[model samples]
Target: METMIGLPFTPKVLIVDDKPYDVKILEMKLREVGCQVAIATDGLSAIEETRKFKPHLVLLDIRLPDIDGYEVCKRLKNDADLKEIPVLFISAYGDVTDKVRGFESGAVDYISKPYEFEEIFARVKTHLMLRSLQIQLEEQNKRLEMLVEEKTKELVEVNKKLAMLDATKNELLQLVANDLRTPLTGLFSVLDSLIYEELKDQLTKDQLKAYDKAKQQMLSTLEDALLLTQIDVSNTDRVYGEIPIQQVIKQALNNVRPIATSKSVSIVECEAKDFKIFGDQNLLTRAFTALFEIAIRFSARHERIQLQLGTFDHHIELSVYVIGYTIPPDYIGTFFDLSSSARLNILGGELGIKPAIVHRIIALNGGSISVKNEGPAGVLFIIKFPFI
Candidate 1:
């Protein structure tokens, strides 16, 4: 009630009543308690006084000269800007129905016309205190919401920058891998020949054997690295064309023919005659080469390596099998992860020969590669490609 006790600003009150005596008594009572008061003789002028005074609270009488208090309360409550201001109904028509209608009209409280001075003060004090608390809570909530929204925006910006940095890092890795391409291929070809030539000559046979094996492993590893790099760095808009699976097999067989002869290894081709697949020819060629090379290296002397071709669900698949070696069960799960290259290199002195690169290339082409141990000593590498 003491509106300007410790502050310069005074809280204003609006009193609306048709009876002149009632209006004068309520105004004097409110001003006695240090609250600023405005008087409106009817419902129409009450709304105008509200706009002009912007009172903290409104005390309205049920009967008015122009309009009833219920209609006035409804209009005030429905308005966007004025709805938040609390209205207390002071009515002479003391009926349960009138009280219910006044509440339905959105007046926060209803007071009887033959009102007690103390009861009126108590209700006003209670409603004003509650309204002040509500205003404080709304202000606090708005501040909290603004803080949360700002933090969310900051987090989004940070995530965006992190994603861009990750993309740039991958691009740099691909560029480095591409630069290694020419030398790696040349080195692999030389290494393949080295193993074949050393095994032929009797003079440096035993000593050169390990070096030759190491060279072969290194070559294979490089090939894997190149393929993995292509998987990440190469454009996805691929040149899809007809590729002869048989020709790829033949070329791969020709490349490893000398090694097979030296080891007395036999080849069993169950390759589909004139079988064609729709994909990037060069990529398919590299995939076939890797499988064939693995088959040749791991198979026993004089043991037959099988090249099989088939189709399922409109997808073409090429499978190569070696008879003597089974992939280690412990290394089965991560057999195609690039990180496995480090493990393989540590174990066998060559990193590039790991299937990590082949897996990446296959995945990039929307294809998949898998291995299965058919029997005690049979290892199958199955590659599936889109029918395209």
Candidate 2:
């Protein structure tokens, strides 16, 4: 079967020879294999057409009228535009010196003539096939390089836009949340007063108890929202000082004590007695606050939540474990991802406790956190900080 393998445009060949019959024969042979041939009867015409035609390959005759093939090959090689094109020398002088000269003059191959008709056909076909493959390879490589460059540029542009959008979003959320804090705090105070004043003598004991519990939960939600907003605007890199492990864990435990009491859950604090680490007090307090809230909300009724702290190798580690309450296995790895906040809300869960934001804050202070679903009961959140 004949192959229809040529450029969609045309596979051009420039044949340089002074003989009319030789040029015609070569032209006819090349056209049989799907190539467009251009004839140049002199060296000067060859050079001129090389510039204009920009042929994919060149066939040259050594004994030209003006410049010999050796000089023509040298001149073609020296031209930057034509240097990459393959040149095959067609010569009648089959001497070894002529062959050597052809190679040294930059011709890729030398063909001796009076050449056999089939040999000429075969040699030209081989060289032209090679040239076509080479051209295709070069074009493919160029396209691949272009694709890689375009993808890299797109990634850089996307990252730049994301950084800008992140900054704007943080600022906007901070403003809105901050503006609501004062009023929310006042509302809590007003609720407290109303509960005592309006229902002092009119309510059954169970009704009063339920109202108080609901009121406390509302205040807890309000605090979480305010802290989350503040975190958005705060610079996470600023570490305050050494907060003794005992004090940090104790404070976190105290904040969640009321909720734990309501749920009848026990908290076992097992911090290393003397361990201390440098960190931002408010930030660490908030981190534990979120963790403690998670324990209180997720632990089974009458279950135990244990807080353990220890120091090892210039790092402080804290482990919060809730007994008998399991986090879903799939969520263990990315439970702290900021985007998981939406998932949590969708499941009718907490509003402001974003694991992603918490992870970022801890990371900024040279610390890390991980949650694992394994062991005795439920999930274990492990936090480690570099002892500064």
User: Which regions of candidate 1 deviate over 4 angstroms?
Assistant: 1-10, 193-195, 198-388
* Alpha carbon deviation, residue 231, candidate 1 (Å): 7.5
Could you estimate the TM-score for every candidate? 0.58, 0.60
The positional error of residue 164 in candidate 2, measured at the CA in angstroms, is 8.7
By summed lDDT, the worst window of 10 consecutive residues in model 2 runs over 1-10
Candidate 2 is scored at a TM of 0.60
The best candidate in terms of TM-score: 2
lDDT of each: 0.76, 0.77
Query: What are the per-residue Cα lDDT tens digits for candidate 1 across 225-262?
Result: 65565565446746767778787678767777887788
Q: Indicate which candidate wins on lDDT.
A: 2
Q: Write the residue-wise lDDT of candidate 2 on 223-296 in tens digits.
A: 65566656665665556777786787788778879888988999998945887767787788777777787767
The deviation in Å at residue 111 for candidate 1 is 1.1
